[model samples]
Target: MSRRRSKILVVSALAVLLLAWEGAVVLTGAQASWPFPSGIIRSGFAITADGTLLVALAGSLQRVITGFLVGALVGIPTGIAMGLLPWVNLAMRPVTESLRSIAPIAWIPLAILWLGVQGNAALFVVAYAAVFPFILNAAQAARAVDRNHLRAARALGAGPGLILRAVVVPSTLPTIFTAARIALAIAWSSIIAAELALGVKIESGGRSVAGLGQLMVATLYVKRDVNALVFGMLVIGLVSFLIDAVLRRLRDTLLPWARR
Candidate 1:
């Protein structure tokens, strides 16, 4: 669909959803206790005013960013090696496949047991979730590098390192970027899961580490705060959507040649 039509549809759908939600709340007698639209807004404002939401957001972002960076740093190079070297690919494929087959959630209990329910545990989980996708995509992209290009570089007396930097890396740049973006999304999801399963314990002056996932669980299940829960959820959705959009835009702009 055209961009304008798509935007209009999205807006219309959102408006309808809001109206339906408001109507349901009003008719169910729940509105008398906790209204819809306004209730969510007020709850969001209250959490923001108290700095709880900001704290949680910051903590969550930190964990995801740290884990993503660490994972990419290791995963990209390992993937490149696997793609370029037959020996490495043969050796690592079985192990990589086996480990990746295990769900990220499965690592939670072990992460908690080994690292405890803290910042490190959350980071480890995020890294685990992010790494495999990055490795798989990067390896495939690198492996698909044109053999003709490699031959041309070699005929020019270019060394292996030079050919990699000049040809293989360039050719695979777009795919690597796409993989990194996917890894970031996975890391974000993993961090949230970790936060819910194993709360972060960021030691500040006296405040402990907090996260949106933990706040969500506390508000929804423990405190029975529906408005706050919804607000937290909306924040997560909006932020993730925004980040992905930006990444896509960046990929298109920076790797225009890849489109050809």
Candidate 2:
């Protein structure tokens, strides 16, 4: 099938799946007090009545961006360095790989102890999540630079710095961008986990301090409010989808030459 047809089919399939899910719940007479789809829409509006949802989202986005920047700032350069220099890679590989093995959440306790389980702690986890993709892929991208190109540049009397700037960088740029996109998703998730851990002081509908994730978790435990959980899940998925789409557009624009 054509790509366009495939996409259309996928979307239709998703709609069907959603309908089936709601229908199944009703058919089984589950205890889930699922609000009608329209009610869910109203609830979304309720969440955003005075912009609390948007504010919380913005805060999370800001933290994610900052952490991603931190990771890329350190990871890209370090990855490139390691990729270019065998000695550096050999010296640091064990440490770097070892650290990557440790899950970002594992550091939560220490992060809270040192930085408090607040915005900074969340940012730290996201930054930590962002780093691995930067370093690992950048190193591989650098390594993938053709030996022929290197030889040609050297034969033309180009120095190491010039060869790197003119050849190595351009060739490896796609891989770096790819790694950045992957890291962006990781950073987003890490920030959400951070928010869940630290909790947001969101005020909504004349109420006060409605911790976004906390509220979702509360609804989840209420047992009857399964619809709320579904709604929250959809919200998160929609946000992540939009983010990934934006990054894909950026990748296409920034590196039109990026190979599939």
Candidate 3:
């Protein structure tokens, strides 16, 4: 139905669920172990007041943006080349296919070994997670470009660069943007997973990383703070939702003709 109605329904459902949870905790005397929704909100407010939430969010966003940009820079051009040139596709397909088959999470250990437990390890994982979608979507989009358009451009004496600029780029950009959205989601997940893994592996002498994942891990394991852990999880979900909404808005604004 309407967007407003859908949002109201979602808010109502969440309120019902939270109230039920709060009632259950009150009835069962489990507030010590299981926090109520109010407790979680209070914890969130405490963290925000102390600047913890903002710092963690900044660290996570920084890594995600850097890694995703690097992935896009590398993947989009490679994908476009593969789609445009059969020989390039033939040469790279086997490697790209093999690499993509490995989950980004699976690369955490290798990243740790190569880059250590620092931010670079998380960046590597995020880039790995972000790149494949870009490559796959860009390639598919390029391949799906109307051959007639290319032919028409060529018939008008367009060279390779001219045809690419006039024909291929416009045709492929919508899908590239779609790929960017998918890659961004993946990058967020990858960075969190990478950060969590690194946090767990950190030694007393090793450098401590800061992110929502690390905050959750610390709260859950070190401090035994369930409220903070839940707050961090909620923050992650909210941030992801907001980022996706912004990306969708950008796509709509820039590529109105490509709206699905």
Candidate 4:
């Protein structure tokens, strides 16, 4: 089907679902706690007008970007080393495999213990969530680099640095970008989970973190505002969709040859 047609179908489906949800809530007399689509829309407007949503979004984005960058910076080099060097792979594979088996959410308690309830704790979780995808994908990409290409470059009197710059990097970039897109999604999710955990753990002591997750938690638990909670959930879904769309467009534009 055409893209336009697919989008129309999706929009129609969403509208039907929303209408069903609104009707169910109204008919069941659960509007007070569950809220209808209309109430959530009004909450979105109120939060946007008051700047609450923007502030929470800014904090979440800041942590996600910073932590993802850190993860990519470290993971790419480590992955390259593992791919290029037999000894490095032998030494690190076991450790990486073991660590990556553990979920990022599982690290939240240790992160909080080591870094406290500050933004740094959330950053640690996001970075942890982001790093494994880069390492795994980059290693696969680097190892798949054609030996004939390297040999040809060497025969042409290219040094290790020259061949790496001219051959290795270009060949690896598509996979690196793919890894980046995956890691970023993981990082975004990790930040939200970390922030929500932090908010619950710390807010009881009269301290709070600023994030969409925190906002959701506050609205649901403390303020008992179902509309705001639903609004925050919708904002999270929209932001995630936008981020993925932007990354997919960037990948298609910059690495057109990699497109399937």
Best by lDDT: 4
RMSD of each: 3.4, 4.3, 2.3, 2.2
The digit string of per-residue lDDT tens for model 1 on 45-127 reads 99999999999899899989999998888889889889988999999999999999987867887887798666678889899
TM-score preference between candidates 2 and 4, better one: 4
lDDT of 4: 0.89
Model 2: per-residue lDDT, tens digit, 95-122?
9999999999678777767886446777
lDDT of 3 by residue, 1-260 (tens): 99999999999999999899999997999988998888888888998999977888899899999999999999999999999889999999999999999989888888888987767889999999999999998888889989999998899899999988888999999999999999999899888898888777763445564887777777777778778888888888887898899999999999999999
lDDT of all predictions = 0.84, 0.77, 0.88, 0.89
Candidate 4 matches the true fold with a TM-score of 0.92
TM-score of each: 0.88, 0.81, 0.92, 0.92
Candidate 4, 1-260: lDDT as tens digits: 99999999999999999899999998999978887889888888998999888998999999999999999999998998888778999999999999999999899888989998877889999999999999999899889999899899999999989988999899999999999999998998889999998889766777664887887777777878788887788788888889999999999999999987
- Taking all chains together, the TM-score of candidate 2 against the true structure is 0.81
lDDT of 3 at 109: 87
Clashing pairs in 2: none
